[model samples]
Target: MLLVPATAATIDRRLTGRSPVDGRPALVLLDLDQVQQPADEVADALARFGAGRFADVRQLAPERPEAPDMDGLSLLSDLMPQVQKALDSGDASQRQALKAEVDAVLASMPEAPAGRDQPRLDGVLKAMSEALAAEDEDAKPS
Candidate 1:
């Protein structure tokens, strides 16, 4: 008769390979303040990092929707579609008018600490504004 004491490392290795598990959740630290890219891109990159190296990776912190900056960003998101629709179908004159409204909304946006969606929203709005302005210029009579 042969006998071997059953242990976690043996069981874990048999089940999943790479045993001697630490039993502590591993963490991946990222310093985003230095990333200088839109938040969505950063988030996408993090999400696409398929789990093999580590046990898990997930959103550790959620954006505070109650934050004032979040509220402004939400408002900008709501307003963006209108701007897009106007650009798509409305005449150049209408686009110019909407552009002023966009500028005002942009100017009124309060300065708040960076959040997940804030940079993304800012980038989209700036790009949209620039596109509308360019279109307006092209529409101008020479």
Candidate 2:
């Protein structure tokens, strides 16, 4: 796998939309070389950017040998549409209901067989997608 240097050009477009990054988001500069990198490295190079700051590798795994970040490609593809529907429906009740469904999926992981934690992550991804779809209840109503 190649090392896709986390440069200013690598800022995730999703983050930039939430808060316009002046240029070259912070995460772009985080150094992933400090870690005991895997043979296949699979560097993520997360840096301070968008709504947050501080840089770190998001994850390092051997199974995925992609040098370029694949964070945008979520495993919960099936659940994303449900999340999008809830968000666009303008139905708070529907969104909350979806969140509960997502939580239940996550909490079920403890009973899952060991070494199968990927399913747990799948649940987390689904839950987060649902939550992200929500209008921040604390935010003044848009």
Candidate 3:
């Protein structure tokens, strides 16, 4: 389990492709400051000290009623494979067309409410755009 000060909404980023050192499933504990209960506090402390200290920790699947609608984020994730495919084809015109499509989708996405996830989402989107631009440069004939 990874304990981070970041909001829980960004847990996806932390857990993606992560593997446990002991072959157990990885878990992420977010927003340590928000932990309210004594049991949780002890667990958090133990986790911070060392994960190996605990012999058995029950994994609880809790519902996130506060999770924001992430349809735009999902759409962006879906578009990435297509973007890579376009890049792999090495067709300049196709790349431009797909870039335009991405821009359109980005422009059309609704403004997310101001919160912990919003900045992270914006950063991810910006990084994606910048990466595409970089890839475009790399693909150009020298």
Best by TM-score: 1
TM-score of each: 0.44, 0.35, 0.42
Q: How well is each residue in 37-99 modelled by candidate 3, as lDDT tens digits?
A: 666666777777776545323454433556644885687678878877876887777777777
The sequence of per-residue lDDT tens digits that candidate 2 reaches over residues 1-142 is 1123354455343332211223332322333365576623333332223223432223422355336324424535656788788777778777778777767656664554665444445655665745654464733465
Better of 1 and 2 by TM-score: 1
Order the candidate numbers by TM-score, best to worst. 1, 3, 2
By lDDT, the best candidate is 3
Clash totals, every prediction: 0, 2, 0
RMSD per prediction, one decimal? Answer: 14.7, 16.4, 14.2
Clashes of 3: 0
Put down candidate 1 lDDT per residue, 1-142, tens digits, no spaces: 0012235323222222222243332222445566789767766665577334332223433434664466757777787787788778748877778778778766776665764346555666777778779888887789
Error of 1 at 88 (Å): 2.2
Residue 129's lDDT in candidate 3: 69
